[model samples]
Target: MTVFRLIITLLATSILGATEGVVTSNSVRLTDGETLASAMDKGALALNMGDVTFIAGYRQVTSIRQDPIIMRFDGQGSDAVKTWQRTDIDATAVDSRAVGLIWDGYERLYVLITVDGGSNDAGTVRRFTNNGWLRDYGSGGGPKVTVALRVDPNTGTPDTGTYIRARLSNGNTNSAVPTAIAFHGDTLVVQLSSFFSPLRVDRQRMTHDTGPSPFPWRVVFDPSLANARRSEAVNFDGVVDIPELPSRQVRLMVGDHEDASATVIVNQTVVARPSGSILDSGIYDPAAPCSFQLHDSIPSSLQ
Candidate 1:
């Protein structure tokens, strides 16, 4: 039997602090002060709606307190193109179950929702970004849920756009466990189990299982690189440092912005990937809350 050992190493690049990235929450008071003409409490889709706000949660069938809401923009100024709010849709390249609507630019409004919630697990992620509606991520079968899909002009069309995730498989929520997530070169160093030495997964495109469903796992492989970022932080007097030696996956809840230092809570979870396989474009489907692999750049040694 030929045993293959793959090594991944994320260099020790200490980021100054947490950078500006998208975070998930139940409700948000639009600080923009832009009073929407009307607001509906749908699900997570409410965030992308135009001239609208406050989407209500009708069928939040999950125990999690923070449920996703969908918002919609009425068809007043739109170029006669936009999904109708507070209405049901059929399975198509545009709107339906397992399908969604991702707002692209001035001429784009995507609708991603799933129609067949059964074994087929068919879903679509289509949008009108530049000029017409296009398929971004199609799903055959996997975890399904509607989430606020946030992306830039480049990632607006799905197909591994910005590498979105519902949750981090290797995360920390424990007070006693000390965790760390450091970026080295282009790789991400996930240190856990001090005695076992720090483990690293090379920069690759992989999918992470982060949905309201049962199966939750992290998948990693030498896929590709889309983008990368770096951040650093300082601990306060009472702040707890790494007590257990080495670990990865630490979550911090920053308080008010005025505070010089933020409150970072050490999350306890070892992120490991048993399969080092690269993901093809067809492996992932959009409109569902399934996790996915992010193609990132890293050192060749780890690959």
Candidate 2:
């Protein structure tokens, strides 16, 4: 009789353990505009919307929604990507490109807008957070800036007589002015006018060698560097190594100088070529042959 009682007790204990292990599956279907709190109130461990799913864990909602909001301007043609509207005001413009979109985890979204016209005076970046719009104006005020270079193609040897020109986004240009040119340790520097600032230039890059035989060098601008801005002249402190060759050349190209109009300047010569014609010098023939023949033909290469 005691053994029978023991068997019955064991069976009861097993049933109790089974009941404790059981869990109720709690989930809720959410609409497009439902809050997380409402889903929690429904005893939901997960919320399923049309095409999105949010999982709840540790008393927190684990899903974030990020959708690009596009605004179209009237009379701006059908190309949606190239046009934009100002969130601050109800103004419509054309050729305003949406450059970037960013979402902050809590409740903020940012949109980077670029204007195609000469001088990005109309361009603005907007932030959407806390149910309102915020505008950010980039660096616009600074002292007059100038870039100078002291370039040495190789150790103990420095080249001379380099020329440079700057093109502004407003269709204005500063031609290859000898007075505006300066040098510093194997780098050619161009002194921009007082009106031009580093913030005004959207992008900058260097081309090792690409032009005519004498100074066969060019600087190609990378559009990706548009956001990279320097308030003052860029200092070259031997950070960028120069090739130890007489034919070694370097050119600096700045794109969208003066605004977001895609203005590009080609001739910002730094470091002169070794003395001697291209035919006479084997260095020019193989080491630095002209890559940009079409641009070489144009006296003042401006685009």
Candidate 3:
């Protein structure tokens, strides 16, 4: 999908037989100012002359210089998702993450990562051109969001959705709720799943307000996917097999738990404001003097 320009020898240090040839330290590289997002999203490729080291599913999370303490990319039976080999700067490996897409603009392939959130990790969003230069942005190489198909809120038809892959949060590693997500276009929608909080209006609260959702509404899987937009068909189990796709454009509100995390996922192009945005904000006011339900329910998760 991308080509190599030049690469740093150090970047090649992690190549355990994964590239065509190893990029030596003497390799000239592009300037650092070129943002990682622009490079990968633009179509940059690292220098991998011809080594078969790059397998489909290889991943890890830990300190780069300290060796990976955690890694995963194998599939379960026939349902496992395939992945690419990613090697960003050593310091960029501070958290659990995965490289999703690679788009290069200037004779290089850009690289992006999906990071795990926690008390220690700030999550990541690193980028590297074909030559293996590093540029950090969009969380620590974190995956952006993409694609969503919500209801009409009134008729329950195909309202519309966005595809910001960066919106989904998997730091839960066990399916925690992504607080908010952008639509397939340029909107946001969120689902408050299960949590330990008793005061917060979670799924139960959602049911009390509306009725129920097709699924639990808050239970999402935390899988290792790079460029979710490109691989969404596989994850969503709704499309045919395809090749690596363009990177998604989205962001995650950093934190954990209710008083800690800010995970959210949008299913449409309209921002779900319990209260609208600042211009006419009054949708989320539990005490607002308004008259609107805002949502409908399905048959599940209703107790």
**Top candidate by TM-score:** 1
Candidate 3 wrongly placed segments (more than 4 Å): 1-108, 113-171, 174-231, 235-237, 243-303
Residue 140 of model 2: what lDDT?
A: 29
**Model 2 TM-score relative to the real fold:** 0.19
The C-alpha local distance difference test score for the whole of candidate 1 amounts to: 0.23
lDDT minimum window of 10 residues, candidate 3: 6-15
RMSD value for candidate 1: 18.6
Ranking by lDDT: 1, 2, 3
lDDT by residue (1-303, candidate 2, tens digit) is 111000001111110111011011221333323344443465534323232223221111124311111222122113212123222210122222222222211111222222222223332112111111111222221111111111121121112111122333453332211112211212222223222212222333222222221121112111121121121222221213212222222232233221111211223221222221111011122222222222234432222
TM-score of each model, in listed order: 0.24, 0.19, 0.20
Candidate 2 wrongly placed segments (more than 4 Å): 1-94, 118-303
* Alpha carbon lDDT of each predicted model: 0.23, 0.22, 0.21
The TM-score of candidate 3 is 0.20
- Predict model 2's lDDT versus the native: 0.22
Question: Which RMSD values do the candidates have, in order?
Answer: 18.6, 31.6, 23.3
